[model samples]
Target: MPDVLFAATLTNRATRLDAVLATMDGTMLRRGHEIYPAPFGPDAFVAAFVRLARGLLRSEAREGVHIAGAALALEAVLDAGAGKVVAMPMAADWGAFPLSERLTTASGATSGVAIVSLTDAALLGEMTLGAGRGVTNAVLLDLSRSVSAAFCYEGKLLQRPYLGAIGHIPVPGATWRCACGGHGHLETVASAQSLVRWMIGRLVEAPATEAAVMRLTGGRAEALTAPQIWQMACEGDPVAAELMGAANDALAHVILTLLLALDPERVILSGALAQCGPTWRDALARAIIQIAPPARAGELAACLALGELGPAATIKGALALARQRVISITG
Candidate 1:
């Protein structure tokens, strides 16, 4: 029998679930079964997941294949001991839910199922198969609607409790309140969601910049995405350029803070903000050089690299974790 594995990722933005089938070595055989427009509550999520898993199982059965193990990734801090989701956004009712147990019972994947944070999943994917492959010490920062980080030390993923919510780290002169009810967090300044809001607010005063952005986004300012603004900045739109400059500096500070503590050999970037063009990549390098300490500036500037897997890192990580669980069980 083939060592087939299953993986899924949950995103609160659209209450979406994406699932895939891959081999034991993390080669994806099939991709992207999106289940969306569903309720965001815990019970609803369980039902949707079971439905998705069952469908996958049935399809595999027809092909004479059996799933060996499975994994799910979500934007939440899971209890390492219990494997329950301890702290998650979007659904407050999900407090300490027995996710592994429920899914295992429903999906009948008796080998094993692993639940991991999207941050850890992405980091694992990078470390095992992408940019950070073969690196012993490194950090992967996920910059999306919110900022979350994962660390690999001596080739092991550090637990979330030890990391202590770096997204909430305070930034000077930042007044925008975060979803965590904190002010001036790194997320407030650098995250894609926050940066878009910041750009929209600035657009009211800079008509020329706003007009430029509107043209790029087809005259719909509301449709302005973080990547579009980034492209505009690359084209020399002053407002967009200024916002990206600040965002990159704040990101550099966060990276520098991590370097001071972890001293990782590489810092891999993922998510939307990491999609900036070569022009902005040069700008970010300049910002890091300008602000980073002179002695270590050159070394720090060289640590940054774009994640090779791009948006697929989390799912790839989930698949890799599933393969690991199957090995552990059968060994």
Candidate 2:
């Protein structure tokens, strides 16, 4: 039987599960996938995983199952009786010992459990198969509801707990508040959700710009999303353009901070915001170069790039982690 690789990624907005059937030689066969809105808590997350896993199983023989998620999701899978599990933490906050203990208690389980960080997985995937391919040093920034970054050096990922919470760091002069009760966080200005909120606020202040975004969202300001804002900006709406520029400036600040601190050879942008395309890229690049130290401006300008894996990046990274586990076992 071909090796079956199951991977799941949970962000604040959604959860995605994907399975690929591959031969021992690493050739992919059938692939199946599913997505759901993110659950509320640990119990809800566990229930969702069980339901998704059951539907995916479809009477296939039990092999190893690889899961990538936050702490609760991994615990849920272990409690649900998946055999020979490999759990990867999608965020730095999750615990490994508790999940490992749960896996150890499962009956008839001969396979061992391994805990890996999703940061490592993402770096590995990028270096091996995605945009950062052949690069020695780089950073992958996931720009979703919350921002997280992974560092890669000498083709290996360096997992750091502080890196996962970089988005929570306060940005100077930011007026919005974060969910964590912090003011001026990068997430308050740079995240897709924050951008949506900022756009809504802009509509309230500038009633004239309301027509375009209201038309885009079908007459509801609350329904306006970051992509819609970008669309409006593309269409030359002054309000949308200003909001996009401000958001991009905030993001550029974050990127500039990372570049100066890490000095990586490449910086890869990923997640929903990155999907806004070249308009967003151009704005971010412009901001980076405008503020970059003149001596290193040319070098920094060449370092920014988009993630090649797109929305599938985290899942692909999880799959790569699973593949590595299989290799280590069979080698």
- Overall lDDT per candidate, in order of appearance: 0.81, 0.62
lDDT of model 1 at position 130: 95
Candidate 1 residue-pair clash tally: 0
Q: For candidate 2, what is the lDDT? A: 0.62
Clashes of each: 0, 0
Q: Candidate 2 has what TM-score?
A: 0.77
For every model shown, what is its TM-score relative to the native structure? 0.92, 0.77
- What would the per-residue lDDT of candidate 1 be over residues 1-331, giving only the tens digit for each residue? 4757889999765287999977777777776565567536777777887787767667666565767899998877787546798866666788888988887777777676788888889998998889898789989988888898998899877876436367788887777898889888989889888888889899889999888878888888887888888888778889888888778888878888887778999888887878774565566667778887899998887888888898889888888888878988898
Against the true structure, whose lDDT is highest?
1
Each prediction's RMSD to truth: 2.1, 5.6
| Model 2 alpha-carbon drift over 4 Å, by segment | 11-21, 25-97, 100-123
**Pairs with steric clashes in candidate 1:** none
- Give the TM-score (vs. native) of candidate 1: 0.92
Model 1 lowest lDDT segment of ten? 31-40
